[model samples]
Target: MSDAPHSGVRFRGVIDLDEHKVHDRPTIYVYEAPVRAWHWTNALAITVLAVTGYFIGSPPPALAGEASAHFLFGYIRFIHFAAAYILAVGFLVRIYWGFVGNSHSRQIFYLPVWERTWWAGVVHEALWYLFLRKEPKKYVGHNPLAQTAMFFMFTLFTLFMIITGFALYSEGAGIDSWQAKLFGWVFNLFPNSMTVHTLHHYGMWVIIIFAMLHIYAAIREDIMSRQTMISTMISGERQFRDDRED
Candidate 1:
């Protein structure tokens, strides 16, 4: 059986389920293949980067054995650097897909900051999250509130971390290296590599917090909102569990 009878119908703002008549929708192909791939790839990359980046920032107690025998910290740094590069490349590919893929792929890159309806969505979604509102707004992709957070917290900070990461790498990569040529300008802005490192570390926390909230919201929506959340990205189809609109 179909997820529900396919329908293009969507509500642009918050709706009270009690007020609207029922309309069933089984599934929609909201996320394209590239978008799905990028989502999971970025998730794994961020997880690895966070754990390894932590060790690189504050290493564990040193081994008692000869320094040459212990390369644990070195391995940690190596993993951090690898994940950083992976994130950076994935960011670029996601940007490219945002242009070539379907409209949903572009939601995170920008926000409808000036739209009055979008602002209303931000407030209503906030209320819904806090349990102050009885019903959450539903969208084909991200609801307005999620769009705002994804653009500012995840997308913008990802770019910030990428630049600062490469800038830090340029330090050891040598001033003549391509990394320096491409990212050395970051030094002109900060004038100190340590400052870049601190900002980069802070950026990591921003992503971490977003990831936590993203997970919480996904699970919450999957249950409370009567819709697919986690599996949408996995299967590339959003299966709505209710006949209610909005």
Candidate 2:
């Protein structure tokens, strides 16, 4: 017997016709345009910040005697600050999109608030990834996992950048700097300002890890499901599956 359906004839084939028809293919949609642009731009800014930040954090011993070479450090700091500003702007744009954008782009959908449905969604998403489940449940906006990770990471980076940034800027102040006073409470909470600074420095590694995993997961989904996971962010169109089977 053939697997393909024939006119009014049920084939006693070993394979299930329903399974073949049901698991036909996967679909996705483009749900975020501004988000896509912001993603790449933020990536660029972070790269600049990481490179300049390293140089600023540790000066080379070779340049110890050359005062003129200090100019390089100055320029690096300037570039870092500039990139920080750009990143900040990107964050603000994302926040706005969360409200005014499509249902898929809405922040509330992704940011769970102890609801049963949300928790269930989280579990479903996890199982989908573990290969225990074949298809991911559809959501108009950010999936629960993506939402949670993005929220946590964005908050961490924003606060870290602001606090460490002000601290570094206050290095020139001799007790008269407003930045120092503003961050004094935070400084006192840590072992020392250097500890806070170091934490902020190391936090980049966390961001790097997140980035790697995120890209890998997206690519994997795109390949397995034929969904344009990455492109949807740029094109704002998603190929949604009309029907899904668990």
The lDDT leader among the candidates is 1
All models: lDDT?
A: 0.87, 0.68
The sequence of per-residue lDDT tens digits that candidate 1 reaches over residues 10-112 is: 5567556445543566699999999999999999999999998888889998789899888898889888889888889999999999999999999999998
Kindly provide the TM-score of model 1 when superposed on the true structure, using C-alpha atoms: 0.87
| Candidate 1 overall lDDT versus native | 0.87
Question: How well does candidate 2 match the true structure, expressed as C-alpha RMSD?
Answer: 7.6
lDDT of 2 at 100: 87
Name the regions of candidate 2 deviating beyond 4 angstroms: 1-33, 58-66, 103-110, 172-184
Error of 1 at 70 (Å): 2.6
The residue pairs in collision within model 1 are 3-26, 4-26
